[model samples]
Target: MVMTKRQIFVVFMVLVLLVALVCASHVTINEEEEADRILQLPGQPKVSFQQYSGYVTVNHVAGRALFYWLTEADHNPLSKPLVIWLNGGPGCSSVAYGASEEIGPFRINNTASGLYYNKFSWNTVANLLFLETPAGVGFSYSNQSSDLFNSGDRRTAKDSLEFLLRWLDRFPRYNQREVYITGESYAGHYVPQLAKEIMMYNKHSKHPINLKGIMVGNAVTDNYYDNLGTVTYWWSHAMISDKTYRQLINTCDFTHQKESNECDSVYSYAMDQEFGNIDQYNIYAPPCNKSDGSKATRQTMRLPHRPHQTFRQMSGYDPCTEKYAEIYYNRPDVQKALHANITKIPYKWTACSEVLNRNWKDTDVSILPIYREMIAGGLRIWVFSGDVDSVVPVTATRYSLAQLKLETKIPWYPWYVKKQVGGWTEVYEGLTFATVRGAGHEVPLFKPRAALLLFKSFIRGEPLPKS
Candidate 1:
């Protein structure tokens, strides 16, 4: 029980070294986070929440980096769950849609001259993270041009996983925080696919992502079912002529992976002729009128040789909000404020990438398999449809969910918000489906109050309000 002086000195020195290491690690993380913080956005109204934006390099050799914007909860952020939002064109910018117009706290003004508060921002309840995924979307990019040209579902999922892993290291406080993934349109594939990767990674990693659930709106689920449902929606809603509907049903073989000329002709006819100048994403909403006094041009997806390339531009309550996002984000001062486009990307910022959309290498024919796997694993899964969205209508979602054949836990019924019928909901054995009454493709933008209520219910693992 006698300790020598040298032994005591060695133990003292070891303790000092450990403390230094800990302090150094903490300082480094703080510095990295501070470097990405946004002091103030151009013309932004005063706000209490903290905002950060920057890039995480997911591939060094390819020099691929993804941009992200984080809006901490309005109050007591540490107590809030972290929700990541994605927008899917397989090439769309979450920053443009999710942050600028939908769930993020700020909305771009009509003139793009200033920012205004969104009363229904999801950040009121959760820490919101918006990602510009798969380089070539928004401010994200790759030094290897081919990476942009050849991006696909598999690569996108892998890159996004890498981004999350590295991003968590930068913001270690959220490593064990409850996390939920959400998106709309093609992110039907992105959200589920990314969750599957996270689940798989957790199996072997000592530090696992605290992934709790996932929600997607107007999502693309299955090729056959989605296509079948889309045609049916047009016919039922009287957006397309019966002849056009029949042609679409008979010519476009949803089960086939390749596009046929007859299918292409009929599909184009339905959009160009039968659909008129109205916004396809929101059947009842007015289309964006150009400043030059011309009608809004149709922006349909008509890829010649590709399958599952049916995503069109997602619009908002202000049909021209996407245009305003383009004008705002491309500004030098705005980019500087948010620490984006640091590499001086060759192209202007856009809501969606045309090159990536056209050149997307792979598309999943069906995402129901992943749904089944996740449901069996007991993860909270929710799929919501904006009832008025013709692109991915309520009928399409119903058709896709029907393929799952899940027993109904709660029979379909109207869900209320503020004593008004917000939508209809039906809880199944392992999944929850709801529709946002009169909402468009971008539910949050078209029906923000209802969307936020649905989000609150999703994270709470509670049913939509019955009253």
Candidate 2:
């Protein structure tokens, strides 16, 4: 039967509805991703928090924001270090970790095990501000769905700078503080670019932000080095076989010069040699292994057993911890705080390993130039990595850093605390790189003591304690 255009339109609409139902059921965590909206801070400390509300219109999209916990040091009225914290997931909430977990005013009590003071908290030493950035990560929101969709390193940094302008106006007191931007994970890219933007704005504006220094942990500053470093980290931890290591190197191009497909093939082949499941450290999807008795069964059956330890600990590795962070993230309010939402959507508290696979965009921003500019402008920069992070392995960080051929005066040396050594530090062309012992991507979570000391030294503009 011949049909009119109107009849065809109705038929097409029906077909679209059917497909929508099927895809909606398959809507994964990434698609359902929404920011953890801030209601109120649960506890009280000797801190002041005025929710900084601001709007940044980017590409005609207006983003609403909330920043928490602002204070001025007692003696340093005119000047003090202003620190900004960012949590990386490309879609994760900074308020979740920066505020509640790592280094804000208070920590959420998870179990009956009594209240745990975030002893390694960064706020004790600096004026810390936790921002839920971009349009959709946390308490920050936008009516524009496009604002929620695409993101990359560049856009995130730009949005953050804009957010700060509104934030500074909301709380104008701390504008003169020596600003230092710091964060972990994907923030490797976030911190440097924001620092650069602040400096760029300072050049033109009258009341410029007195920017000082920047810090990042287990940073994803460089993609190539971080990727190759993953294999080295896996091998050190004994997660992979020597045969697998050889296979990885042979298959993958560590240079990071080639397309991602070529690198994926190498990583994919090495993963196939082991259990047929996704290797979270390396981004390659898992292959099926029949003899391994299915991943779920092996995982369930291995419950009461201890997995074989692979990597030999370096000189100062603490056996007791290294596993404490995994234990900490599993608690309930920690879950609630991380997943707090204004809109009704299911939110999981744990960090998403395959974050980019979600609706989040690969930020097209290049932060290397930012880092270079910061160095040129005499702003001190520190990039630290926790040795045990699988997500953004320290080894991969080393690879990423190799791209910056800053003239090296000294080889890597150990940074110390009291009489005990904390981690290694490398100095090249006015930039500092340090490693925190027994920590992961989130430096404060696993090794708060070291993390605190690191910031204390940073705020003082002192060389990190020498070993």
Candidate 3:
């Protein structure tokens, strides 16, 4: 084999190009060094800093990058539990829920008015940390905008782990503090996986994570159970009809090997109950639109984007509604809290829809197995649910808890806060199953008072406030 001058040159050029492409694909990596973020909430309870703005460099698909200006907790260092809050949607930002709606220093006054102080903020008892993770959420950005899309559970957990490492490095004091991971919805997947990873690393790493317990609300831990639970939740809420319920059982076998017409029928029924409009129903309940050229649907469903918002117009925007949060987040003070350089990227606090234009591989991990592992290793496991949620019902959480088969050293009982019964708690199978009384899927939002109480007790290793 003889190598000609021209061929060799061509081969060399191709190799150079390949290397250049690889470099260009990952040019935006970075880490933080002694940075501070500040926020101010006008007319809210006075604190040294009304907002929390900090930076942590993360290595993801885009290499080194900084996630900037997530909200912080009020100083209660003595009893402050290091709490991490996560928002679901698989692509949703925790900054939206943790800061704007639930237990942040401020609350959105959706009437285009201004910000309001949340008297029941969780920070009063714990040091909360809200993160916009995976290097593409909220203030978090990468040199590669393409990094914004195509994300999955494994990547999310890894990226979050990096953020934790960096965060702990910056705030080393909390390394040995009680760390509790809590989130809602899709976080059902995120929190459990992250906790498992932390627990695993702690077992063998030179620098172990002082991992404590985790809590999820209206969480989606088991896809199969969750899908069926959706039907059950809706039925319990009286959101669907008896006829439709019967149709689901008769036609759809939840355990069937394949998707069937019966399943389609059940889905359609649920959709009709949710949103009456064919256009609106497609967003979340697409399977329920199949009906005979029938009379008008039972009742036109509200737009999925902000149905709960409209439903709670007279009351406060149901913290459950994305609209409620968006309306408040769009306020000027809220923007100040963000501290993002919008010139670098467009920051829309509330996305137009839930479907994220991203791609990523799905991993198979079970919370029950992870729970058992953590328990075996002497790590605490807490599973909390909002009783009123129709999204991830309390029943499903109970089912997940039962699978662990841990002994019931502590009996089920009520816990109290502020002299008012706020929720229930129990110790079973070496895990705690607690409930927040008036919350929805976004437990903190709907039940901040109870949520704060729950967090305080968690950090102190005490029983929850009983109702």
Candidate 4:
């Protein structure tokens, strides 16, 4: 067929435009993909799922960035829900603890030689995102040193919410996926605060986050209830001496804004008595054999104990996983594979940064009010406690939940796993409370199978298996 010169010219221009569009789309995809891709870790096992680690700048002016590690679901990544897991140190590394140790698809083996598929990995049904939040925690950092000093609850939530929204631009696939924020310890504060931020944003946002629910384990939800329940647990468990208990009752005021001199002295003595030789996170569990010891006892300071050790889930994971993680993360090849420490961080990458913890400011004393608000907003909330965790024990969680005073939707009952009792569960209108039979501060680490069952039931909005 013969065509006129004008027709040929028009066809040529259309083809050029199509090519340009395709090239632009390719650039966008590859830019986001290559920046976060993980080829392989030093000793990681081959996996069907894709994993990514990189920084998302939260504050460009301050050069502050948060690090995230995301592992897609092995079977159907696109269909899986997105779970963003944060570790609670106010200064902890979620990637180091949550991703590498507890609920990640693979737990860094004790020797750090290779990875093995975690039989109970949460990612089996969800895309799990582990974030080392706040500047100066793990590999996340800031150029302005003052940013670290100003870190706290409000700032953390703002930064995290911004990080999530900004992150959506990079991985648009998850922009509309349902988001479930889960964490333990200080994350009790982080998760709810972040969830509240999302809820607030939803009020004004045209493109809102698809926030569905939240889960927290051994969380620090309230100052009064948390402390009241903690001291009561310590005394009831025979952890502190009778005299010390008496002193705690008479001299210590858990409701006090700051500990009095007498309370400080008594509390120090009680802590030393209970936690000196073992893990306070799990009273019955053995101490970490790797680290020297908690900073409380390291010096001769008679001051009250400070928060230390983001080495979480110590009860279920290898007490020495911290040591293995240190060995693995510090390897040059491993960092290169993960695309970490690109700016040549000044210090070695520690699992938890004391600087971040020390510099934290504006942290909430309690998150109870936020919990009330979120629950009233019809957001699903689940609070689970590890029975054996003395730091934030089942007792403390029960006391906190009691404050909600929500009548039981489902009466407390034993939930079974594999024909054996895994734990007891209580359902409330806005919440579900469960206890891992003998798990420690970190439930998944110690009771992986049971933890998985709990998570599965949670996403499905089902009651724990009674039979």
Model 3 lDDT per residue over 1-467, tens place: 99999999999999999998877544422123223445354444456533445556676456545443333455657445578887665566676666676667676554635666777877776677887765565556666655665566787788788889877766666678778888776687778788877876777789887777787666666545554565565666666787776766566654332357657655665765653433221112212222363322212111101122112111244323345556565566655655554444566555322324234346343456666666777766667887765546776677656666677867888777677767777887667778876655556766666787776676677766444
Candidate 2 deviant stretches above 4 angstroms: 1-40, 43-63, 66-79, 111-116, 253-357, 364-366, 409-411
Q: Write the per-residue lDDT of candidate 2 for residues 64-144, one digit (tens) a residue.
A: 443343433334434556788887656555655676556765554533222344555665676667776665664455555
RMSD of each: 2.4, 16.3, 12.1, 3.6
Q: What are the models' TM-scores? A: 0.96, 0.70, 0.75, 0.91
Model 4: lDDT equals: 0.81
Model 3: how far residue 362 lies from native, Å: 1.4
| C-alpha lDDT score of every prediction, in listed order | 0.88, 0.59, 0.60, 0.81
Residue 39's lDDT within candidate 2 is: 33
For candidate 4, what's the RMSD?
3.6
| Candidate number with the higher TM-score (1 or 2) | 1
lDDT of 1 at 282: 76
Residue range 251-331, candidate 1, lDDT tens digits: 788865565898888877777778776777777766777889766543333222222222223433566777788899999
lDDT of 1 at 408: 96
What's model 1's lDDT at 315? 39
Model 4 steric clash pairs: 316-445, 316-446
Kindly give the stretch of ten consecutive residues in candidate 4 with the minimal lDDT sum: 296-305
